[model samples]
Target chain A: MRKEDMVKLISAEGFEFVIDKDAAMVSQTINNMLTSPGSFAETQHGEVTFPEISTTILEKICKYFYWHLQFASGKETEFPIEPELTLELMMAANYLHT
Target chain B: MMGGICSRKREQLVIENGGCRGVSERFCKIASSKWLGNSFSRPIVDCQPGRGKCPSLMDLCIYKIREDIDKYSSFSILPRDISQQIFNELIHSRCLTDVSLKAFRDCALQDVFLGEYPGVKDSWMDFISSQGSSLLSVDISSSDVTDSGLALLKDCPNLQTFAFNYTDQLSEHGLKHISGLSNLTSLSFKKCDAITAEGMRAFSNLINLEKLDLERCSGIHGGFFHLKGLLKLKSLNIRCCKCVTDLDLKAISGITSLKELQAFSSNITDVGVSYLKGLHNLTMLNLEGCNITNACLESISALVALAVLNLNRCRLNDDGWEKFSGNKNLKVLSLGFSDITDACLVHLKDLTNLESLNLDSCGIGDEGLANLTGLTLLKTLELSDTEVASNGLRHLSGLTNLENLNLSFTLVNDSSLKKLSGLTSLKSLNLDARQITDAGLAALTSLTGLTHLDLFGARISDSGTKCLQYFKNLQSLEICGGGLTDAGVKNIKDLASLTLLNLSQNCNLTDKTLELASGLTALVSLNVSNSCITREGLQYLKPLKNLRSLSLESCKVTASDIKNLQSDALPNLISFRPE
Candidate 1:
C-alpha cells in the first residue's frame, strides 16, 4: 500500500503498529481524529497515541478492524477473544465507539 | 523510565477505585499534563484547551464508568454533557435496560427520544422525570407509559416539545399533567383514541403552542374552543377525526394565525369551509373526502396564499372551476377520484406554477390533456385509471421537467409511448395496462434515468427484456406478466442496483433464472412465486447477503428448503413464503 494510505498507532508501552488507514478507521474516534476539519496532531502526522490502551489490546483491535471489513463484504467468520481480555476490550471498544 | 512507571501505578490506582469521582479527576489531570508535555516538545501541533483535539477528561471518566456500570450508583456527579452522551450511547447500542437506566437520574439531559423502544413502562418514568426543569423535548410514542407515568413529567416545566403518538394507555387525566408546560411549542397525539373534547381543555394553557397534530383522535369534536387562546398556533391536523363537523370549523375560524389546516375525511360541509374565508394567511388546505361541494371553492377563492389544495373525493363537478383561476400560487393540486370531467380542466390551464397535478380515476381524456400543454413546470402527473390514450400523450411531450408519470389502467398503448420518449427526466414510469405490449416497452428505452418501472399488467415478452439494458439505474422493476422466461432473466441479472425485483406469475422461469439472478447482491425483495423453479435453485441465493424478503410460493420448492436456507446462509432474510 502507499505510505499515505497507512497510519501508525502507539500503545501505552511505546510499541507501534502500522496499519491501513481504512482499517484503523473502524474506530469512530480515530476516524474523527483523522478526518475532522480542525486539524489535530494525529491528523497532521497520521499517527495516534493511546495512553490508556496496552500493546496487546491495540494489536487485537487492529485485527478486529480488518475482520470487520472482511465480514461487511460478505465473508462470515468468528472473531476470537480470550476470556481475560473481554473486560478491557469492551472498555476500549466503548471509548473508541467501535 | 521513572515517569512511565509512575503513570502505570497511577492507572492501576484509578482502576482500583472502581471509577469513584475523586480518583477519576486525578487521572484526567495526569493524562492532560502528559499530552501538554508532548505538545510542547513537538511545538508545531498546538493541543489547545476546549479544542477537543485530544479526548476530554469527561470522555475517560465515562469510559471507566461504562466499564463497570453496576459499581456506580448514579452519573449525577459528571457534567451534563458527559452523562447525556453516556445515556445516548446506551440507548443507541440497545444496552439500556431498566436497571442500567437508573444511572442517568438527575443527569439533566435535555432530550429523550425513546420512541417505539420495547419494555419502556411506567417504572422508567422516575429516571426520565429526574431530569426535572432542564428537559426540553421528549418523545415516548408507542410506549406503555400510563397516566401515572405521564404525571411524572409535570416536574419538567421547561419542556418545549412533547409527542405521545399512539399511546393508548394515556387518557384525559394524563393530559392534565402536562397542562402547566406553557413553553411547549409543538405537540402531537396522533391516533390516540382517549383524547376527547373534555381532555383538550388542558391545551388552553399552552399559549406558546404553534403546531398540534391530533390526527385520528376520534372523540375530539368540540376541542377547537379550548385552542382559541393559543394565538401562536400555526398548523392543525385533524384528518380522519370523523366527529369534526361545521361547528368545529366555526370555532377555529377565530384563530386567524392558522396557516395550514388539514381536515380531510371529516364531516365538514360547504358551510364549514365558509368559516375559513377570514383566515387569509392559509397556505395549505386539504379538504379531501369532505362533504364540501362547489360552493366551498367560492369561499376559499380569497385565499390567494393557498399553494396546496387537495379536493380529492369531494362533491366537486364542472361548475365553479373558475374559482381555481385566482390561486396562481397553487403548486400542488390533487383532484383525483372526483366528478370533474374534460370541461373542468380548461380552468386549470392558467395554473402555470403547478408542479404536481393528480387526475387519477377521473374522466379526463385526450381533449383534457391538450389544455395542460402550457404547464411546462409540471414535474409529477398522475393519469392512472383515466381515459387518457395514445393521442393525448402528444400534448405532454413538451413537459421536459416531468419526472413521474403514471398511466396505469389507462387506454395508453404502444403508439402512445413514443410521445414520452422526449421526457428524458422521467425517473419513475408506471404502465400497468394490458394494452402495453413489447413494442411499448421498446419505445421507453430512452428514459435511462428511470429508477422505478412498474409494468405489472403489460404483455412484456422475452424480447422486451432487451430494452431494460439501458436502465442501469433501476432500483425497483416489476414485470408480473406470465410472458417473462429464463432468457429474459439473463438480461436483468446485471442490474446491480436492483433492490426489488418481482417476476411472479411467470411460469416459464426455471432454475436457470435463479442462477442468472444470483449476482444481484443488492436485491432486498425478490419474488418468483408461480415460477417453475425447484429446490435445487435455492442454493443459488446464498450470495445475496442483503436479501430480506424472498417469495417462492406455488413452486416445486417446499417450506423446509427455504427455512434451511434462511437458517444457514441467508440469516438477514426476515420475510419468506412457504412457512
Candidate 2:
C-alpha cells in the first residue's frame, strides 16, 4: 500500500494492469502456502517458500499496480490530466482481478 | 451592465461551509458608493469603506428585505467542493443526446461549462488536448466533422473504442486518419460511403484490433488485407458491402480468431464460401441476401461451430435444408422469404438443440409441423403466413420450454387453443389475424402466466372479457376488431397492471371508452384508431398523463382535438397520427 516503492506491469493488451502480491497470503492456493511460508504469514516455518509465481512476473505485476494507484488518486483536481494514463491504469486493474 | 456582472459572479459563487462570503465580497465591490448612488434599485447593506460617513438610507432599503442572499448564509448548505462533485457526476453519468451536444458546443466559450465551473476558459484548451492522449472511447457520429479535423485524436495512443457514422460525409482521407489509430480494439464505421478498398488497407495496420464493422459501406472493394494478422480479431461485419466479391472471403481463411462474421448482402458464392472451412470457431454467420447456390451448403456444413444462420431470401430449397440437418449446434435458423418447402423440415429433425426457428412465408404446411417435433428444446417458433392449420399445432405442445408462439396466419382456429393450454411456459402468444373465436380464448384461461396476449382480428367479442381474468400476469391485451363495447373496456379495470390496451377498429367505443380506459394510470400506448372517439374522448385522455403514443386515426375528431393532445405533457409521444 506504500505509494513510493510500488511499480506496475502493463500487459500487451491495453486493457489490463497486474499487481505482484504474496500469493500465499493473497491467494488461497495450498501449494503457494507451503513453498512461500514467510510470504504467506509471519511464522516459524522457514523451510516453505512461495511457489508457482516467478520473480519476473511478480516484479512486472507490482510495477503495474503502482502506476495505476498513482493515476486513480490523481484523477480529481483543478488540472484535468490526460485519460490515456487512466486507460492503462484501468487495464492494470482488470489484470489484477484475473 | 456593471451591476449585472456582480450578480453573475454571485450566482456563480460556490457554497463554502455555510457562509456566502465569497459572493458577498464580489457583490460589495460592485455596490461601491460611486456606483450605488446611480443605482435604480434600492440597496439593503449599509456598510461603507474608508470614510467615517454613516450608512446611507439607500443601503438600508436593499438589505432590509428578508429574501436577500445574506439571510441564506446561516444554513449548512452544500459545500463548494461537494456541489462541484455532484455536477461532475451528473455531467459524466447523464446521456447527452445529439441536440444537447450541439447546444453545449454552440454556447459562448465563456458560458460553456462555466456556469458549473467558473473561469474554465483558460483550462479549456488543455482539457481538449489532454483528451487525445487519455480518452479510451470517442463517439463523433453524424457530426459536422471531417478527416482533417481528426488530428485532434492523433495524441490518443491509448484509444481502444471508436464509433464513427459518416453516412455519406466520409471520404478516403477520413479513413486514413482512422487507420492511424493502431491501438483500437473496437471500431464501427457504419454507412461511411467514402470508405473503399484503400480505406480497408489502412486497417491492416491495426494488428491488435478485435472487432470491426463496415456495415453498408457499399463502395469498399477487394480483399487485399486479411485479418490473419489480427490474431485477436473476433467479430467482423461487412453487411451490404456490395462491391466485395467472393474472392474477399478467401482472406477469412487466415483469421482463425473469427467467431462471428456477418457478410449478409455481399456477393459471396459457393466457391468463395468453401474457404470458410478453416474458420472452425465461427458460431454465427448471416448470409441473408447472398446469391448462394445449393453448392454453398457443402462448404457451410464444414463450420461445426455454426449456431445461428440467417439465410432470408437466399433461394434455398429442400436440398439445402437436408445438408443442414447434421448441424446439431444450429439453434436459431431464420429462412424468412426463402422458397423452402415442407420437405425441408425433414432435414431439421436432426437439429435437437434448435430453439428459435423462423419459417415465415416459406410455404411450409402441415407436414413441416411434424418434423419440428424433433426439436425438443424449441422455445420460440414463428409459423406466420405458412400453409399450416390449427390441427398441426397440437404436435408443438411437447416442447416444454416454448414461451413465445407466433401463429399470426395460416388457418389457426379455436381448436388450436387446446394445444396451447399444455404449454405451461407460454407467456407471449400471438394469434394475430387468425380464425379464432371466443371459445378459443376461453381455453386460454389455462395459461395463467400470459402477460402479452394478441388476439387481433380474431372473432372474439365482448364475451371473451370474462376469460381474460384468469391471466394474472396479463399486462398488454390487443383486440383489433369491431368487437369491444364501452362495458367491455370498463371491465378491464380489474386488470390492475394493464399498461397497453389496443382496441383499434372497435367502432362502438366513444367518449365513455376513453373515460373507462383512463382509469388505468399506467396506459402507455392507447390505440383508439378507426373508432367513434369524439373530441370529448380526447378531453378524457388529458388525465392519462402516461399516454405516450395515442392513435386516434379515422375518428371524427377535428384538428383542434389534435392540438389539445399535443398541448398535454405527452412526454413519450414520439408518433401521433389522427385519423
Candidate 3:
C-alpha cells in the first residue's frame, strides 16, 4: 500500500500496527478521528494512541478490520473470537462503533 | 512572561498531582492546565511542558465525555460544536436513553434525524425542543409523537424543516401549532391520514414552503385551496391521494411558480390536467394511472420546461400524440401500458434529448423503434412485453450511449443479438424471452462491460455456458430457463464477482451443481428452487458467508435443515425457502 494510504495505531503497551487507512476506517470512531473537522492530533500525525486498549485486542481489531473489508466484498467467512476475549472485544467494538 | 511562568508552575503542580491517577486523570490535568494557559497566551495551549504534543482539546473533551457520559447532567458548559458531536456519538451508539438525553437539553443541536429509532415518544420532544432556535431540521418518522407532542415544537421559531412521516397519531389539530413557523421551508407528512382538507388551512401561513410531500394522504381532498398562498411552493406531491380531484388541480393551477407536480393515481382526469396549463414553469408532471386521456396531452404540451413526464396507464391513445412534438426538453418519457401504437412514436422522433423512454407493454413494434435512431443520447430504453422483434433491434444499434436495454417478452431472438453487439456501453441487458437460445447468447460476447444479465426465460443448455466466460464483470446473473444442468453451472462457478445467482427451475441441477458453485463465495442470493439438489447440497453453501436469501423450494431440503445451517454455517442467511 502507498504510504499515504496507511495509518499507525499504537496500543496501550506501545505496540504499533501499521494498517491500511481503508481497513482502519472500518471503525466509525477511527474514521471520525481521521476525518472529523476538528483535525485532532491523530488526523495530523496519521497515528492514533489507544491508551485503554491492550496490544492483543488492538491486533485482533486490526485483523477484524481486514476481515470486515473482505466480508463486505463477498468473501464471507466467520470472524472467530475466543470466549475469554469476548468482553474486552465487545467493549472495544462499542467504543470504536464498528 | 510572569503569567507564563506562573501557568507553567501550575501545570507542573497538576502533572504531579495527576501522576498516580492514570490516563483519564492525566488527560483531565492536561485539559485544566491548557485552560489555565489559555488565559495567559495562545501559544501555551499548542505546546505542553513535558508531553511532546497533545491531541486537540476538543477531541480530548469529546473522548472524556464519551468515557463518562452518565456522570454529567448537562453539556451546556462545552462549545456548541463539541456538545453536538457528543450528542451525535451518544445517539449513534444507541446509548442515548431518556435519562442520558437530558445532558443535551440546551446543546443547540442543528439537525436531529432520529427516524425509526425505538423507544422515541412524546416525552423525548421536550429535550429535542430544548435546542429551540438552533434546531433547523428534525425527522421523527415512524415515531409515536401525537399532536400534543408536536405542539412542543411551536417554540422553535427558526426551524426550517420537519419530517413526521408515518406518525399516524398526528391529527389536524396538531398542524395548527406550527402555523406560526413561517420560516419552515420544507415539510413531509408521508402516509399521514389524519391531515384532511381542513387541516391544510394551517399551511396557508407557510409562505416560504417550497416542497410538501403528502403522498398517500387519503384524507386531503380540497387541500390545495389552503396552499394557494404558498407562493414559493415549487414541488408538491399528492401521489396516491385518491380523494384529490379536478377541483384540487384547479386550486393548484393558481400556484404558477409550481415546477413539479406528482398527482399519480389521483382522481384527476383530462379536465384536471387542463387546469395546469398556467404552470408553465412545471418541469416534471407525473399523471400515471390518472383518468387523463389524449386530450390532456394538449394542455401538457404547454409545459415548455417539462423534462420528465409519466403518463403510464393513462387513458391516452394515438390521436393526440402530435401534441408531444413541442416538448423538446423531454428527457424521460414513460408511456408504458398505453393504447398508443407505432404511429405515436413518429411524434417522439423529434425528442432527441430523450435519455430514458419506457414503452413497456405498448403496442409499438419495429416501425416504432425506427423513429428512435436519432436519439443518440438515449441511455435507457424499455420495450418489455412490446411487439418489437429482431428487425427493430437494427434501429437501436446506433444508440451507442444506451446503457440499459430491456427487451424482455419481446419477439427478439438470436439474429437480433448481433445488432446489440455494437452498443458496447450496455451494462444491463434483459433478454427474458423464450426465443433467446444459446446462439443468441453467443452472438453478443463483444459487450464485455455487461454487469447485469438476465436470461430468466431464455433456453440455455450446457453448451451455452461458454458465452458466460466473457462476462467477467457480471455481478447479477439469472439463468432460470430450466435448461441448465450441473455441467452448465460448472462454467459459472468461477464468476467471483457474482453476488446474485438464480438457477431455479433447472431440474437437471443436482447436488453436483451446488458442489460446483461452492467456489462462488460472493453469492449473496442463491436460488436453486425446483432443482434436483438434495439436503447434502446444503453443506456446499457453508462457505458463502454473504448468502442471505437461499431459495431451495421444491427440493429435498427442509425448513429445519435451513435453520440448522443458519445457526452454525450460514449465520448471515436471512431468508430461506421451506422455512
Candidate 4:
C-alpha cells in the first residue's frame, strides 16, 4: 500500500503513527484490525471511520501499526524506537484498547 | 560485442522489473550473444523468442516504479553500507535459520571464502570484515564447526557472551583456543563431557569471566579447584557434575561477588555449603537433589537478601526449614517433593513479602495451610497433589490480591469455591482433575478479569457454559475431559478474546464443534485433539491467520491435514502438532 494513501485512510480513524511500521505491529490485534475492512467500524453503518480517535493519535497509531506489520512480515525497515518510546506506544494502544 | 552489451543492459533494465523479467532477460541475453550479428535484422522472435507481446509503456513504467520504490530498495539490492547494516540487524535479532541465516553467514564469512572468488572486489570484502571486530556474542551450539572455527574467531577481541550446546565436540585443545579472547564475561558449555580440570583452569586466564556453566560435564574432576584466578566470578551453574564436592564449593566461597548458584544433582553436602556463609550477596539459590542435612541451612540463613530459594527433593524435614526461616528477605520459596508436614507451617509466618509459595505433594492439611494466610503479598499459591480439603481454600480468602491459585487433585467442591469470591484479582484458577460440578464454577463469576480458567477433568455440562459467557477476557479455556458436545461448544463463540480453547477428550464433540470455533479468528492456541473431530473439522483451522501452537495429540488427524500447512503459510505459527 502507498504511504500517503495509508496516512489519509488512517487519519479518518483518529491516530498519529509517527514511527516506522516495526514498533506498531507488536500488538497483533491492531494488525488484524488494519487488514480487515469491517474490523474498525466507526458507526452502525460500518463506514470505517475513526471518529472517536483524534488525528494526532490516529497518525501515531497508523505509523506504528504499519511499522509493526512491516517488521512482522519480514520486510526490512529501521530498528524499533528506544524502549521508552515503545512504552509510550503501548500506553497509546492500551488507551485505544487495540 | 558492443551491440550485445547494450541489448543485455536493456534486458537487465527489464530484469530489474520483477522475478518474471529476470528469467526472460537471462535467456534473451544468452540467445542474443550466440547469434551475434544476424540478430538485429532478424525477426522480432530472434531478439525476444519466448517473449509475449511486450507490455505497454505505461504498464512497464508502473512496474518499474513499483519495483524501484518497493522491490528495488530491498536490503539485498541496496548499497553495500545499508545492506551491511541490514546484515548486522539480522545478526542482532539473535535467532535465524535457513535463507536469512545463509544471507547473514555469507556476508560475515566473506573473508573466509574470498580465496575462491579471486575476482571479487576488495571494497565489499573490507566492508564485511570490518564488522568482525564489533561482534560481542557468538552461539556455536549444535553445529559441526570444530576447533578450526574457534581458531578463526580468535580475532574477535570484544566478544563477551558465548554459548555452546553439545560441547562434547570440543576437546581440551578447543577450550584453550577461547583463552585468547580475554574479554569474555559470560560463557556456557552444555554437554561438554571431554572437559577436564586442566581444561577448566585454562579459562582462569579470562580475568573478566563473571558467569560460567559446565552443566553435564561428567569428566570435570577437580575442575573447579583453582578459584584464586576467578576472583570476579558471580553466577555459576555446575548441575549434573558429580565430581564436584566440598573442596570445589569451599574454593567458590572466597569469590565475594558470587550471588546466584545452582548445584543440582551434585555431591555437595552440609560441609560444602558451610563455606557459603561468607557470601552475603547471594539472592537466588537452588539445591534440588542434593545430599544436605539440617546443618546446611545454617549457612543459607546468612544470605539476608535471598529472595528465591529452591530445596526440592532435598533432605529437608520440618527442622531444616525451621532454621531457614531466619532468612527474612525470602519472597519465593519452593519445597516441592520434600517431607514438609504441619510443623513446617510455624516457620513460614515470618516471610511477609512472599509472592509465590510452592508446597506441592507435601502432605499438608487444613491446619498447615492456615498458617500461610499471614503472607498477604502472596499472588500465586500452588497446593496441587495434596490432601487438603474445602476448609483449606477458606483460609485462602485473606489473600485478596492473589492472581493465580492452583487446586488440582484436591478434595475441594462446590461449597469450597464460595470462599474464592474475595480474590477479585484472580486471573488464572485451575481446578483440573477434580470432582467439582458446574455449581462450583458458577461461584467464579466474581473473578471478572479471568483470562485462563481450567476445568479439565470436571463434571461441567452444557449448563456450565452459560456461566462462562460472562468471562469476556478469558483467553485460554481448557474443558478437556468434560461432557461438552457440539451444542456445548457453540457457547464459546461469544468469547472474542479466546486464543487458546482446549476441548480434547470430549468424545461427544463432532466436526460441527470445531467449525464453530473456526470463526474465532483471534485464536492462536487451539487443541481439539482426541475428540471425534475428523478431516472436515481440521479444515476449519486451515485459514486461521494467527494460529500458532496447535496440538492434535491422540486425535484422528491425518497427514494430508499437515500438508495443507505451507512452510510460511501461517506467518505467526510457532508450533503445530497433529496426530
lDDT of each candidate versus the true structure: 0.81, 0.61, 0.80, 0.63
> Candidate 3, after superposition: displacement of residue B488 in Å?
1.1
Which runs of model 4 end up more than 4 angstroms from their true locations?
A1-98, B1-85, B88-132, B551-557, B565-578
Q: Going through the candidates in order, what is the number of backbone clashes in each? A: 0, 26, 0, 22
Each model's chain A TM-score: 0.97, 0.31, 0.96, 0.38
* RMSD, every candidate, angstroms: 16.0, 20.4, 17.7, 19.0
1 or 4, greater by TM-score: 1
For candidate 4 chain A, the 10 contiguous residues with the lowest summed lDDT are A79-88
- In angstroms, the error of model 1 at B233 is 1.6
Tell me the spans in candidate 2 whose CA falls farther than 4 Å from its real position. A1-98, B1-129, B223-228
Q: Is candidate 1 or candidate 3 better by lDDT?
A: 1
Report the CAPRI category for model 1: incorrect
Better of 1 and 2 by DockQ: 1
**CAPRI-style grade of the A/B interface in model 3:** incorrect
Better of 2 and 4 by TM-score: 4
Q: Candidate 1 vs candidate 2: which has greater lDDT?
A: 1
* CA lDDT for candidate 2: 0.61
Ranked by DockQ, the better of candidates 2 and 4 is 4
Off by over 4 Å in 3: A1-98, B1-96
Model 1, B406-452: lDDT tens per residue?
88789988987999999999987888789899999898889999987
* Per-residue C-alpha lDDT of model 4 across residues B503-547, encoded as one tens digit per residue: 767777888887788778887667666677776667676667767
Error of 2 at B123 (Å): 15
